[model samples]
Target: MEDIIDKRMVDQSEMSYTVDILNKGVGQVAKKLLEESSELAFASVEQKSTADIVHEAADLIFHFLIMLKATGLTLNDVSEELESRHKN
Candidate 1:
């Protein structure tokens, strides 16, 4: 049986980060996201190990999702945007 409950667990983690970031204010969340993004890009450009790059990318995405949630946006908004662009 395919377990469909994984999304909820992932969302709970995201929600916890969102709440923590929002408590510190949007600026903190934005700063963290920028840091994560820079690290990910740097790792990719520098030809880092695959595992290292993957770790950095995950941090970037987690922070990005926090920023999105802090700004009252959901992952669905991004998905919809990408989907719309695909249709175009």
Candidate 2:
């Protein structure tokens, strides 16, 4: 998924709604993330199955990646931070 996003970010000729939102800047990515998070929060207790939570979580992650990319960050950057925090 990271590779896909990375490739598409440069060659944006095949722009989809997600990519369009990404082009709009960090705020759009953040908005999508917040919306997804709200859905996931409600789904956590209200939804009987884990499917709803998983679906929302995936959306959240996708938007998060978009936001991260917009901010000139990557999953490896996040992973490094997590690893450093773990070692502390």
Candidate 3:
């Protein structure tokens, strides 16, 4: 996913949503993360189908990766934090 994002960013393809959000800067990325999270929360609260929940979850995670990239972080950084907590 990071590779795809980097390629899209470099290619600057007008058709790529990743490029669009990244071009808009971190604020837009954060806004999208909030939006996706809200959709996931709504799906859960409304007792939507499992598929709906999973779909929303995937959206949230994809945006999360975008957010991490925008912030110069990576999944490994996040995993390390989680691992530290697990050991605590």
Candidate 4:
């Protein structure tokens, strides 16, 4: 006996999907940065290896750029914040 499968019965849209919920023009970059930071936190709790953490950190930085793009900010803004903190 042979079994039959129906592909047409599947609803593609019902499947899980990921979407960036941030606004397209201004908040996207910041949203991505926040997402990356969350991932880093998760990785730390999960006890991921050092190499993995490093890679995740890199990803976080890249996402930060996206966030800056979204928020109309720049690396200089972040740098200035860091500088002020160092003085304290």
User: Candidate 4 has which clashing residue pairs, if any?
Assistant: 26-70, 29-66, 29-67, 30-67
When sorted by TM-score, best at the front, the candidate numbers are 2, 3, 1, 4
The lDDT for every candidate, in the order shown, is 0.75, 0.85, 0.92, 0.58
Please give, for residues 11-87, the per-residue lDDT of candidate 3 as tens digits.
87456899888779999999999999999999999999999999999999999999999999999999999999999
Ranking according to lDDT, highest score first: 3, 2, 1, 4
User: Residue pairs in steric clash, candidate 2?
Assistant: none
User: What is the alpha-carbon lDDT of model 1 when measured against the actual structure?
Assistant: 0.75
Query: Which candidate ranks first by lDDT, i.e. highest?
Result: 3
Q: TM-score for each prediction?
A: 0.75, 0.90, 0.89, 0.56
Could you give me the TM-score of model 3 versus the true structure?
A: 0.89
Best by TM-score: 2
What lDDT does candidate 1 reach at residue 12?
A: 62
The Cα RMSD in angstroms, rounded to one decimal, for candidate 4 relative to the true structure is: 14.0
**Candidate 2 vs 3: which has more lDDT:** 3
lDDT of 1 by residue, 1-88 (tens): 0121234334666565445566787899889988999999999999999999999998888777767766777778989999999898
Local error of candidate 4 at residue 45 (angstroms): 1.6
lDDT of candidate 2 over 1-88, digit per residue (tens): 7887888877888987767988898887888889988988888879647887898889889888888888989999999999999899
Clashes (backbone N, CA, C under 3 Å), per candidate, total 0, 0, 0, 4
Better of 2 and 4 by TM-score: 2
Cα TM-score of candidate 2: 0.90
